[model samples]
Target: MKPLNPGEPRQVGRYRIIAEIGEGGMGRVVLGLAPDGRLVALKQLHAQFAHDPRFRERFRREVATSRLVSGAYTAAVMDADAEAETPWLASVFVTGPSLKEAVDAAGPLPVESVRLLASALAAALTEIHRAGLIHRDLKPSNIILTSDGPRVIDFGIARVAEDAQDLTGTGAIIGSPAFMSPEQAGTGQVTGASDVFALGAILVMAATGRGPFTGPTAPQTLYNVVHGTADLSDVPEEIRRLAEPCLAKDPARRPTPEQILNHLGPVPPGVAPWPPAVHARIRQQDAEVRSVLALPLPVWRPPPKKMAPRTKKILFGSLAAVVLLLVSGIVALGLSIAEYAKPEDPGVASLAVTEAVSPERLRLTDPCKVLAGRFVKESGTLKPESGSLHPARCKYTGLNGVTFNLQLGESVTVSGLERTDRTAEGLPLLRSTISGGCDSVVQLPAERRFGIVVSRSGKEGDPCKSADDMLTAALARLRTHEVDRAGDPASILPLDPCAVADPAVVGKNIANAESAPRTLRICEWQGGGNTLTVELNLGAYVADGSPVDLGNGVTGDLRGAGTTKCTVHWQHRPLPNREAEHVTVMMLGREGSGSSCDPAKEIAASIVPKLPKP
Candidate 1:
C-alpha cells in the first residue's frame, strides 16, 4: 500500500479512504475504514466506464450477484453503489500479499502448500458458481494468501452465466492470456468449466512459477491455449496428476469444483499456510495497516484571505525572500544529515542502502550495460568480448593479457573483505585481493552484490587500481543510463533455465541426476560421472556445426568439443542489435564416454519443444 497523493478523495460514501492499495486495468483499489470501524478493500471503477449507462446497469446486476457469494475462501462483498458517479464496491479486507507477489519474492510453493492452495481455491469456486456467477479472471494476482489459508478475491469481471454472451459480444477477451481456457481463447462458450481451466494453470504456476501455456505475447499465448500442449514437466508429480485433467482440450472432460475437492481429499490443518518469508511480508503489511489506522485523519478547511492588490504584492515579495533563506538552511541541514547517516560499520551502512534500492527494481536491470565498452576503456584499452554465458554477466579482454569480468545479482559474503572509504553512488564498496586478480563488490539490497574482477597473468601493474577505476565508471553509468531488459514478453531473458528444461529428460540422460542452478540463466545436472549444463543467454548464434532438426519445428546446431564434451545450441528468437536469444545444452563425461553429442541432441530436442516460439 502507498500514501494517497494530492487531489485523491479522502472519503467515498460512508467509508474513509486510508491509502491506495493498487490499481489494475479496470479500476483503483483502496483501503477504507467503514463508519463502524471495520477495514475493507474498496474498488472504484474508472470514470470512462461509469459514463456508459448500459455498463452501469450491468455492473449493478453483477454487484448484486457478487454480494450473494459467501464462502470461507472468498472475500465477501459487503456493499456497493452502482448509481454513484464512479461505481464502487467494498469487500472484506484480507491482510496478505497476492499469490503473484509471494511467488515472485519467495519462489514457487512447495507441494503441500500448493495442495492446500488448490483445495481452498476449489472451495471458493464452488461458492462463486453456486451463486450463478462466473469469475472470468482467476489469475495468481487475483488470489490472496493469508495466514489461515488462501482467499480468492477480485470478482469485478464476474457476471451471471446467462449474461456472459452479452458481455462478450464485442469479441474482446476478458481474461489473462496465460490463464485463459481454450474456449475463452477462441470465440467459444465460456462456463464454470472455463474457470476450472484457469485453476489448472494457476496450480501449474504455484508449483513451478510459470504458467503451463505461457507464450511471450498475448496473441501467441492465446494461440497456444487453443492449439499448443500444456508444459507440466516442471510441475511436481503430485500436483501434475490433478492439474492434467483440468487442462483437457474438451471442457466436458474437465472436473467440476466439487469433483476437484473430492480428488484432493481434505486439506490438512496448519497455522501458517505460506512459507516463512511470505509470512514475514504478511506481518509487515499488517503492521503498516495498523499504523495507518492509528494516525488521526487530517481535517480540511478553506483559507480565509482578503487583501488589497498593493498589500498582496508586498507580502509576496517578503515571502519569497524568507523562502530562499529557508531553502538554503534546509540544504545545509540535509548535507549534515547525509554525513551523519553514513555509518562506519558496513553492516549498519547496508541498511541505508536497502532503503534506496529494491530487489524488484534490480531484477529488470541489464548487467551488460553496467560494464559497457566505454566504462571498460576508462580502466585500460580493453575491448568487450562477445557475451558471457549468462545474461547477468559480461566479459572484457585486453590485448595486454588482462581480463575483466563483471557479474550482477550475486549473493556475496563480505565478512572477510576489506572495507574502504570509497563508495559508488552512496553504496559501500568492499575489496579483496587474490592470487592474480583483485575483486570489488558493491553491496546492494538483500545481500545482493555486484562484483568486478580484474585479472592478469603477471603483476605488471596494480590490478586493484584497475578494478577501482572500472567500478567508478560502472557506477556513474548506472546512475545516468541503467539499461533494462527488453520489454518484449517473448524475450527469454526473464526465464529460469532450470525450470525450462524437462526434468524427466535430464534424469533419463544422467542416472541418479541432481539439478542445481549455477546462476539465474544457467542450470547443471550431474550424476553417474556425467554432467549436463543448460544456459539461456543473449549473443550472436554460432552456425559452425551441422543443423539437426529438433521437435516442434525447431532446429539446433550440434557440435562436438574435443573427446569428452559435446554441445547443442539453438536460437530461440532474434533480439535487438546483432544478438539473438539462444539456448545451449552441453554434455560432459569421462574421457572414454562414447559420443556425448547423441545425448546432448536428445536433451536439446526435449527442451526445444517446451519453449515459447518467436
Candidate 2:
C-alpha cells in the first residue's frame, strides 16, 4: 500500500486525512480533519504489521487501556479501528514540534519552558497510571509542545499487564535506549517509573543539546546507561537536583509518578478535577454493557397471593418488629461513621515552588586577555582585525579578558588571537555561536581562532567581499576536531570548520534570482570539528527569464526576483557565549541579482564588523 502524502485529502471511516505530520519505524501519522473540520493526528500502522494477528490484539488492548485513562496533558484519542486492514488511530493534533526537533532546530529550551513541560508531562503520567496503564515509550519524540502544555502521545505500546500477551516479545526493546529504564531494557516490564526515567532523560536533553548517554556502539551505550552515572555537570543545580532521583539505576530508588508530580509543584484545583470526562464516558460504556447483558429475557411467572388470614397477620407483626430494629441499628452506625470522618487536626499543607538559578560565570587567565588597544574605532563603525575587537572588560584569574554577557535580542562579536607562553591557553576563547535559531542556545569550545587568514570579494551586494582575501585567510585559520559519541551516531559541529566556507558565497544562483527552482543541500564535514556546507542546484522547470517572488520579513518587500539559481552560504558559531543570542538566516531569490548571496552571512558581516563602540 502507498504511504499517505502531505496535504493530500482523503478519508478513513469518518476521519479525513489532511497531511502527513510525521513518521517513524512503527508507522506514519497524518494531520487529519474530521467531518466537523476539527484537526486530529491519525496514526496508521504499516500494512505489514497489520497482518499479524497478535499485533492487532495488542492494538485493541492499547485502545481499551487508553480509553480508561484521562488527563489534560495526554493527547486524547478521538477514534480508532484496530481491526482495519491497515489499523489506524486518530488523536487530537498538537500544534508545536516534538521536543527533540525543537531543541535541534532551536538549541536548548528555556528554564521556564522546561519547568512547565516537566509539570505537564508528569501530570499526564499520573493520569495514565491512575487508569492502570503504563506508557512504555516516553522519549522526547513522543512529547509535543502544544499551546497549553507538553502533551505525551503514542500510547500504542502502553501495556495493561493483565491484558497483555507479551505482543512485543519477551525482552524486546520498546522505547529509545538512551531514555529507557533499566527494567524496560532488561526484562520488558514497563511500569510507570519507566516514564519517570524518560522524563529525566528529557530534562537533560532540554538543558543540553544531547541526551545523557552517547557511545560509539549500541552495546556500549546500553552498558553506560545500565551501569554508569549520568554526566549532568552542565545542568543547573536546581534542575539537576530535581532530576537526579528520576534516573536512579534501581527502579525501587526511582520516584513514583505521583512523587514526580509533587516535585513539579502544585496544580490549581479543578484544572483536571476528579471524575474526569473520560471516567464519565467509561461509566456510560459500562451502562451500555449492562443493558446488553440484561437483554437475555427470563421466563415470566405470576406470583400467587392466596395466604390464610392468620398467617398474614403473623407475617405483618414480624415485619413491623424487624423494621423497628433496623432503624435503631442504622442510626447508631451513622453516628459512629460521622464521628470518625471528622477532619483530624488539619495537617499543615504548604506549596513549594521549584527554585530558579542564574547562569554561570566563565573565568579566564592572563594569556587569554583581550586588548581593547587593537580595535579601530570610527564615529559610526567598529573594525576588528584578527587581534582586535574584544567585546567585554573583566579581570579574573590574574588576567584581564573580555567579559561576555549576551541578552535576548542582543549580540556581541569577538575577534583576536590570545597566544599563551604555554599550550594550555593558546587559542582564542571565543569561537562561534551555538544556537539552533533565534529562540535556542548551545555552548561551543574556545580553541578555534588561531593562525588566521582573511579574504574579501569585491562584489556590490557582498558586504564582506571587499575583505574576501583577508576573510579567506581568517577561514584558513580554522582547524577541524572530531567530537565522538558512543551510542548515538549524530555529531556536534564546531565553530572552526564554519570559518572555512563562506556561507554567503555557497549557493548564489538559486537564492539570488527570482523564479529559480533549486535544491538546497546542507552537508556536514568530518574532521577536528563539525562543519556544515550548503549547496543549491537550479531546476529546469524554474523560469529564469521572469522574476519570481520570495516571501516578506522585518525589512519591507523581503521579496526576491529572477529565476537564477542562487546559492547562499552560512556556518554556525560552534558555541555561543553566555550572552550571545541565536540568529535566523533566510534565503531569498530575486531577478537579476548576483548568485552569491546569503541573508544570514550577509547580515552577519554587514552588522558584525560595524558594531558601535561601548
Candidate 3:
C-alpha cells in the first residue's frame, strides 16, 4: 500500500482514503476507512473508461451484481456512486494475497489443500450462479485466499447470465486468456460452466506454476483454451480427477458446481484450511486491518449481540478493552496496536532518502563506464548524444532501433511497491511507474546529491529486469573508482522538464493544470481530458509533422492537427552540438474528438523561449 497520488481524491463518498491497495488492468483500488470504522476497498475507474457510456453501464451492473453476492467466500459490495465524475465502487476489504501471489510465492497447494479449496470454491460459485450472475473475469488474481476460505472479487466485467453473451461488446475482452472457457474464448454463450472452466484452470495454476493452457500470446492462449487439453502434469492424482471434468472443452460436458461439491464431499468444521505460507500472508493482512482500525477516532461501542457464547465472549472482551481504553486513553490504543504490528522486512531498506554520494569524484570517469557490462555488450555500439542538457549521459542505438540512455544523476519518480527491488548492493531500486518502458533508480540518501539511473526508450522486454541488471553492473563498476566517462561532465543537469513550460502555458492548453514530474526529464500534467503527458528527448523527430517556427530560431513540428491527439514538438537545442533536444506538448482528446494542432503549436511557442538557449 502507498500514499495517494496528487490527483487522487482523499474522500470518495463516505469513505476516507488511507492508501492505495493495488491496481488492476481497469483502474486503481484504494483502501478507505468507512465512517463506521470498517475498512473498504474502493475502485475508481480510469478516465479513459469513465467517459465510455458502455463501460459506465457495465460498471453500474457490476455494482449491482457485487452487492447481490453474499457469502463467506465472496467479497460483497458495501457502497457505490455510479454518477460521480469518475465512477467508483466500494467493497468490504477482504484481507489476503491473491491466490496467484500465494501460488507464485509458495508453489502449488498441497493435495488436501487443493481438495478443500475446490470444495469451497464450488460452493461459492453455486451461490453466485444461483443469483443469476456469471463471473466473466474469474482468474487466480481475483480469488482471495482468506483464512476462512477463498473469496472471489473484482467482478468488473460480470454480467447477468441471461444477458446476451458478447463479453467484449464495445470494449476489450476482460478475462485472463489462459483461464477462459471455450465459450468465453469464442465470445459465445457464457454460463456457470465458464466459471467452472476458469476454476479448473486456476487449480491447475495452483498445482503447477503455470496455467493449463500454455501459449506464447493471448490469441494463442485463447486457442489452446478452445482446443488443447490441460497440461496437468504436476497435479496430484485425486485433485486431478476432480479438476479434469471442469476443464472439459465442451461446456455441456463440464460438471456443475453442485456435482463437483457432491463429489468432493463435506468440508470438516474447525479446519484452518489454508497452507502455512497463506496463513502467514493472512496474518500480515490481519495486522494491516488492525492498523487501519487503530487510527484515532471517536470511541465506538459494541453493537447489540445475538447472545451466543461467541458473542458473550466478544462482549466481555470489548467491555474490558473499553474500560482500559477509558482509563488509559490513547496510550491503551497504542499498546493494543503494538501487539499486532507486523515485523519489518529485514531485506528492505529504510525509505528515508540518504544523502547522495556526489558523482563529482568520478567527473573525469566516462559516464559510459556505467554501461560496461554484459547487457551493454549485447545491446551493441555506444553512441554519444548531447541533445539533452543533462550532464553525465550516454546513449546506445541498438540494431533494433531501440535507444538506451544512461543518466548518472538524481531523480524523483512515481515508483510503486510492485516495482521495487533491492540491488546486490542492497540500495533501494525501483521502476519509475508500474507501467513504463525503463527507469531504475538507486534512491539516494535523503541528503545525497544524485542516484544512478539507467533508462531505455522504447517498447521492449521487461524494463525492470533490464534496468536492474544495468544498475547492478553500474554499482559494481562505480565501486572500483574506474569509471567509463562519456560526453561532457562539466555541464550541470538540464532544467526540470516541467520548468520548460510555465503553468500559464500549460493552463492555456490544458485546464486546471497539475504538474507531475514523471522523471527529471519527463513531466505530465493531468487536467484537460484528465491527462497530457510530456516526455522530453524521447526521440529526434516526429514521423509526420509540418515544420513550423516557435520564434527566436526555434522550430517545431506539428502533428495530427484535426485528429483526436494533437502533438507539437519544439527542437530547443540546435543541431551538431547534440542530438535534437525537443519538448513535446500533447492534447489527448476523448474518443475521436480533439483540438487542432494550432493550440499545441501555441503552447509549444509559449515554452520555447523558456528552454535553455542553443
Candidate 4:
C-alpha cells in the first residue's frame, strides 16, 4: 500500500482513507478506517465510468448480487452507494496476495494443499450458486489467499442464472479464457455447471500448476475447450479423478458444487490451509498491513518524488538462463529472465532452472516432423516452415488462423522440476500459463526446456490439450542420448525464451500474460489489450530512441506508436564486457492509447535486476 498523495482526500463518507491499495483502468481501491475503528477495502469507480448510465446500471446490479453472496469463503460487502456521483463499495478488508500471486511466485501446490484449496473453493461456489448468481470469472486471481482460508472476490461479471443463458449464449465472449467453461468459451448456453467446469480447471491449476483447457491465444484456448480433451496427465491421480468429471466438455456432464462438497467432505477448522512457504507470504502481507496501521494521520505530507527503479545486488550463483514466450489479448509481449534462483533451490528468491548442457542429454535435429498430422492444408493453412538452428524448431500453418509450433532446448537443473505442474507422457511440464497460452516440456533428467508450444494470434482460453497433443506427438519422434556435457542450447535462436524467464518478475508487470514462440529469439504475450514482445538480438540491435535514465547509470529507449506499431526497448548486459548479451522487451499497441513506453519502462525496470552481472 502507498501513502496518500497531496490533495488526495483523507475521508470518504463516514470512513477515513488510510492508504492506497491498488489502481487500474476501472478504479482505485484504498484502505479506510470506519468510525468504529474497523478497516474496510473501499473501491471508488473512475469518474468517467461511474457517470455512464450503462456502467452504473451494471454496477448497481453487481453490488446487489455481491451483497446477496455471503459465506465463510467469500468477501462480505458492507455498504455501497451505486447512485452517487462516483460509485463506491466497501468490503471487509482482506490482507493477502491473490491465489495467482501465490502460484506465480511459488509454483503449484502439493496434493494436500490443492485438496484444501479445492474444498474451500468448492464450498465457496456452493454458496454463491445457491444465491442464484453465477460468477462468470472464477480464475486464480479472483481468490484471495487469507490467513484463514481462500476468499473469493471480484463479482463484477457475476450474472443472475436466469439471464445467463440469454446473454452468454449469444457469442458475446467474456470472462478469463483460461478458466472458462466450455459453454462460456463459445456460443453455448451457460449454467451452474459452467462454474463447476471452471472449478475443475482451478483445481487442476492448484494441483499441478496449470488449468486443464489451454491454448496459445484466447480463441485457440477456447477452441481447445470446445473441441479438445482436458489434459489430466500432469494432475495427481486422486485430484485428477475428481477434477476429470468437472472438466467435461458438455456442461450437463459436470457435477454441481453441492455434489463436489459431498465428495470433498468438509475443510477442517483452526488449522493453516497452505504450505509453510505460502503461509509465510500470508504472514508477510498481514505484517505489511499492520505497519500501515501504525502510521500517523491527518498531516500535510510533502509529495514524495517517484522513486527511480532501484538497483539490486550482484549475485554469483550457478544460475540457469530462462527463455520466456509471453502472449496476450489486449497486449502481447514476451520476457526472458536470465536472472533466477540457484538451480538446487527452486524457490522464488533464487534463480530457477534452464538447461544449458548435460552429459545425459539428447540433441534434436528437426522439431517439426513430430506433428505430421496436427496441421492441415486448408483455406487458412500455410505450409510448414523450419525455425532456428540453435535449439531447433518447426512452425506449421493452419486454416482460420490456426498455427502450431515446436521448439527444443536443454534442461534446467533438477531444482526446476520441483515447480512443475504435471507430467505428460512421462515428461515433466510447467503447467500454469501466466498469460493464457498452452505450453509443455518433455521430461529430461538435466534439461528444463524440452518444449512444444501451441499459440494462436488472438485471445483464447487455456490451451493445455493442444500443448499436450504437441508434446505427445513430439515424444513419438523424440530421440535422446547420454552426452559428455550438461544439456545447453545449441545456439541462441530457437531456444524457449520462457525457459530463462522469472514468472515472479514478469507477474509483477503483466498479471495475466499468455505467451508463444514468435521466433527463435522473439516471444510475445497477449494481455488486457496490451502486447509485450521480447527478443534476444545478440549484438544485432543498436538503440536509436532517446535514452531514459532509469537511475543508477542504466538507460533504455522508447519508440513507436499504438497497439501494433509502438515499441519499448532496452539492452541487457550493456557493451564493454566480453560476456555482454543483447536482449530487449518491446510492447506493441495501437496509436492514441497513450505512450506504450510507459509500461515498457516499467517492465524494463523489473527485468534488469534478474540479469547475470557482467
In terms of TM-score, which candidate is strongest?
A: 1
Candidate 2, residues 490-588: lDDT per residue as tens digits? Answer: 111111112223434433322332121011112222222212233211112212222222222112121222322332222212223322211222343
Model 4, residue 44: C-alpha shift (Å): 2.4
Query: Evaluated with lDDT, which candidate comes out highest?
Result: 1
Candidate 2: residue 131 lDDT (0-100): 83
Instruction: Give me the runs in candidate 4 sitting further than 4 Å from their true place.
Output: 164-171, 298-614
- My TM-score estimates for the predictions, one after another, are 0.51, 0.44, 0.49, 0.49
Q: Backbone clash tally for model 1?
A: 0
5 Cα displacement, candidate 2 (Å): 4.3
Each model's C-alpha lDDT? 0.77, 0.48, 0.68, 0.63
Q: What is the lDDT, from 0 to 100, of the residue 238 in candidate 4?
A: 88
Q: Write the per-residue lDDT of candidate 3 for residues 1-614, one digit (tens) a residue.
A: 66567775567777778878887767789988787778899999876578768778878888777788887788888999886768999998988888899988888888777887888788889888888898888888998888888888888877887763543563234578888888776656788899999989888887776898866444446655765668888887887888899999888999999999899888988888778988998899889767755665333333233357788799999999998867587565564323223322112111122212333333334565445332443344334453544435776554356566677655544334344647546576766643357777765543233556777666566656666776766665565433523222111123455655657767876778798655445677877564566755533444358888888787677788787678877655434544455677776766744565666677777766544334
Ranking under lDDT, best-scoring first? 1, 3, 4, 2
Name the 10 consecutive residues with the lowest summed lDDT in model 1. 342-351
Q: Where is model 3 poorest over a 10-residue stretch in terms of lDDT?
A: 345-354
Residue 179 of candidate 1: its Cα lDDT?
Answer: 95
lDDT of 1 by residue, 1-614 (tens): 89999998788877888999998766789998887778999999866467757667767876888998998999999889886778999999999999999999999999988999989999999999999989999999999989888899988789899887686455556789899998886757899999999999999999999999886544456657876899999999999999999999899999999999999898776446888998999999999999998888744333234457799799999999999998689787664322223212111111233432333334445666555554233234445566444566677665455777766655566775788887776767788776557777776644354333333333557777677767665555554323554444455665656666777888888999998766556788999999999987777876778888888888888888455799898899986666898999999987787878878888998888666557
Q: Can you write out model 4's per-residue Cα lDDT over 236-279, one digit (the tens) per residue?
A: 99899889999987777888888888998866767677878888
